[model samples]
Target chain A: MAVASARSRGRLEHPRRLWVVGVIIVAAIGFLLAKGLGSSINYFETVNQAVALRSSLGTTTFRMEGVVVRGTVHQTSRGTDFSMRSHGVTVPVVNTSSPPQLFAPGRAVVVVGHFARGTDKFLSNEIMVKHSANYVAAHPNRVKPGANGSS
Target chain B: MIITRRQARRPLTSSSSRRPGSLVRTATGVVGLASVAATVWLGLWVTPPSTNLGQLVRLLYIHPPVAWVAYLAFGVTAAASLLYLWRRTRSVVWDRLAAASGEVGVLFCGLTLVSGSIWGKATWGVWWTWDARLTSTALLFVLYLGYLALRRVPSDPGTRAKRSAVAAILAFADVPISYLSVYWWKTLHQTGTVLNPQRQVHVHGLMAWTLLLGFCAFTLVYAWLVAHRYAVEALAERQQGEGLARALAERRAEGRAA
Candidate 1:
């Protein structure tokens, strides 16, 4: 009779134990979500998503990636303005300060800045010109290149 | 096992009469308090300001060390989780340790984010960015949060432990990746400044020594947090046992009355 009672009690406490465990997990997730949401969106996005979401982005700062259109790069006294092309769509980029020396035609570029409302222009604060596969192959010291690189 | 009514009502220590356990508890408490005190004092006031940022640079002393401690706690969680999974018999203890460490780790990680942001707002024109170090650290914070959440989803203890252990192990991968992502990627976040001995020698005088002392103090505080957390978990388990025993005894008495 004592053995049966002990077994029953153990069984009863089992659910409570699980409940406490669940609470701890929820607390952890809540903590992370709270922090993550406080920070801005800085995660990876393909050119397609950037284009599709272009309308709603407004003037908020963001990052976008595309290939530099061959004939669209024009350097002014202020800085350089160029058009980035991806998936047959083009967005004008105005860089107001120092552009990377590597910025040029047909290069993959990631511009960190903002998109103006009602226009296809992106005002960039920083520009990163993606290195090609040959740059990685020629330089053995470099690790994996961009997202498209393999071997 | 259901405790007898007599044992349930017994004085806490009378049932156990464990001297070594009490000694361990006292030692853990003392060490924990001392560590926290030392870390706070040395990290904040004792450290001198940087020439460039002046007083604002003091934020760096608190922020980086807290970040390091968080990583250390997560490492403990991963190792303990692995042990629990490997030897399933004594896993409850290990799982408790993992959970404790995860909580403290998350707390320190929060501190890191706060202090880092405060420093950034003072130094840089912006609050945050997609820089490799920042992004990876943020991901790490998220991954551990998810790991903790996995422990809670299931009602079965055995199933929860299994799943939590797996999550802990998998999330450990993010730590190294977070540390090294800056080296691999072209990131705005400056590469690690303190770890390399050669670079350490070159840093402007007071800043280097302050950081060194900060690391030491933070490590001790981390040890203290883990120890205290483990003890709290043990005490909670005992209280839980008592609650169950009391419930069983009341049920028995009601049956007799009926």
Candidate 2:
């Protein structure tokens, strides 16, 4: 009789355990969907988009993408100052953070910050280099310094 | 009704007929290793540095191939799970295959994250980011991990296999979403090079060939791993069944003596 009762209890608990696992899996999926899709959909805005929305986006932190205009990069005491251009619109950016090793003129970059108050210059705290999927062999003479001199 | 220990051990013994399967597995492993070595030699020495990415482009040979293998592994898991769920095709072999592939998928997914992180740090200037592609891929890694954990929960074989098969299929929904995340949203990670929707070949010459070799190498490795893992799963299940039978025999013997 005791063995029969224990087996019955075990059978009853089995479905309950599965129910708990089901609830947990559902909850985890919902959390991941909310976290992944909610805030990161618009990772960064283009220079033209940010410029068009400048009035409404005043001083709000956001990320903007544009190519660093040639001959516009300058190292200052605080950081680097450069102008980025996209869609024929240019925005001067004063980045207070050190740029990445790959940061260079004519390279596309995404800067994280906002427009400075009372000035047209964008204040950036971070810079990220962006490269396309296209891969071309570097010319013998055009190879950048310190790039595995074997090439 | 008495059973000897030798009878229990009989199920665990391998017959000589299985030699061909072992030979095939060994051949697959050897070819996989040889190709991986070739990829390393070519990727490091032969392929010229890209004008834009410089020497960092070498990471392309490692990251994308492993990422592709991860996708392939999960795809196999989903297909096997579907087979297990279908009444006509339902069998323990499918369940074992699904579990084996899912485990291997997690390993490759982890390698994907590590290799991608290293590449990101050098090229993107950050070790990590919460962009759409990165986040979705991370979610995928975690989802498979959850599937593996659910498979471990104690239950009767049939119940455990059924539930885990369902979980495997559901977890596979994340694989396509992760792959398409770059197109579905603006992301920091670059778009696909070879498998892009445009089908344009961004890679060329020796560089392209090296990348192709890397894909084939990693795929062979994944196949070899799944094959070995499935054999181990089969052996373990047989051992468990034999142990249960022995325990039941002992109980009956005690009842008869009493």
Candidate 3:
């Protein structure tokens, strides 16, 4: 009977107990990773925060995020200039590079730049448009009629 | 999905045609190969270039689908792992399914990161950034790597299943965070263009059509891949059982006689 029992095969020994321990450890690690995300958020400031800290932010390079004020975008030989606002505070940004196609009025953006405390302007090295995953028309009339082809 | 004790006794051999599900596996292989060829054609030649990125927009056809399937595969793995935890349904089948999905998810996850880098370099003039989305995506890839590694450690089948199931569940926590990283924080990465229904659609016209087809094609390929992988795992398990049986018979014969 002992030999017969030895021949029988089944699950590995101690799986159930080890699994419980693994679950605890994994959950703890996941929680730590989530908490770490707070400290590692991308932008250093919002538009309002940047303005409020303009004096201290003097010439210090940083990335700031804000919504582009509508109709404030302009094309210039230097590149592009726009106004971004948040929480009733607005900052003028001059980006010395062509903006992405998504960079337009009434969109959210992050600008990598330094504060020109004397001129009260943000001199941007790069401009990035931020939006959700939802697709919007890249432009009106881009799609022809009868495009409701969801299958 | 059922494997009887008798079936387990038989080892995997060249005579696989005698195996119960070998026919379906062969058919799946053919379909999967054909779909991949079609995808390559649509992605390279058929899709139009973007107004801005030009030829680089062709990445749109394959990138999104690869990313989507990676997410889908991980999601399935987590679900299967959870099922394996249930007392009534606790079995190695669910564990093997989870592992198969994990392997495929990692393949596509790597593809997604590479394709994304190529597209970014074309448009952003940069190959990489430590932005919120990019970092979270990299984290996701690492988590999957850890999960795969955990599966390979020497252990009894039951213990391995339990550990891997837990790894699958934990690794999946990153998937949602990676997807929502763009919306949750400001980053150099572009917002979600294809999935946001509440906002205006960025991709329009024939691009949208090709993207939809891309998803369909990749999803079908994933299903076929998983099916075949499961069959292979079953064959391997059968072989292991036969090897053990042979060792046991030899030991018994040694003690009993000349």
Candidate 4:
């Protein structure tokens, strides 16, 4: 009976336990390797915190966040600059880089850049806009009246 | 009557075998407590705050370790569930391990999410994003929750174990994908760093060692929790087996009386 029990356990341990252990070991090694090598990975932050610490922010090296203020966007030779309002503060953003498609009025956006000395302006390196939870319509204005030769 | 004579002789054998469990519990508990406390202390106090983020960097103490422990627990559940299914023996012992690991893993996973969000808010200025890694980790959490629910289904033990084993295996697959999603695609979630010895060593001396200790401490706590939960499972299984045996015996007596 002891031999029988041992045999059964041996059979059971083969595919399930051993296979999983193998996978975990391989994946862990891969993960460690990637981390061992220098990788640029940034964590997300919010607008309120960014605005509160604007004075101390390093020039062009930190990230900032706020809602895109209505009619604040202006196209420049390099890219665009806009006033983003968050937590009742207006953050002036200078985007020398292209913005994400979703950037517009009332939309929350995060900008990675550095605050310029004396000007308190943020020179952005990257821009990411947050989309709302509701599924966006495939056509932004499906009911455009007579705009596309429609009745 | 024949079986009773044999069983009476086995009582002494069973009594002598009870020490291993208590010994294991004590050892695991001590190690787990020490490691986790040490990690938390060193991580929060010893590590130099990020040049950029200052004390808000303390969020690293909980986020990475909690994430790692969640992975470890899911691996434990997958292995145990597979073994139970393959053995075809209704060992409630293994099931208990699966259930405990899944629940604790979920708890840690949730903590990782919360701590990560706080860290992000402090660093990036947004609470959440639909990044690849974040989405996958959330899915992984939901999958494990589903695995736990499968165990509670009213069915024969063998059938339930077999059914849950498949889900456990899928959860294991998700672990790697969740970890790698950032690297393989455009993701807002940062790739790993603390576990990489090379990178960790290069980090400012105080911060590196503190985070390392924190990882070790969380691992110990995880092991202790698993062992404690496993013991409770063993006791419950024993009670269940005894109840079934008594029911069977009573039914036999009723037939004889009839």
**Best-performing candidate as measured by TM-score:** 2
CA lDDT of A118 in candidate 3?
A: 80
Ten contiguous residues with the weakest lDDT in model 2 chain B: B9-18
Go through the candidates in order and give each one's DockQ.
Answer: 0.06, 0.35, 0.16, 0.03
Worst 10 residues of 1 chain A by lDDT: A131-140
TM-score of 1: 0.59
Cα-lDDT of candidate 1: 0.65
Model 1, B42-83: lDDT tens digits are: 557765543233455566556767888888999999988888
Per-model clash counts, in order, read 2, 0, 11, 18
What's the lDDT for all of these models? 0.65, 0.86, 0.73, 0.65
**Candidate 2: tens digits of C-alpha lDDT, residues B232-257:** 88887766666666666889999999
In candidate 1, what are the lDDT values of residues A64-95, reduced to their tens digit? 77788778889887788998877777888888
Q: Model 4 compared with the native: what TM-score?
A: 0.58
TM-score of each: 0.59, 0.87, 0.71, 0.58
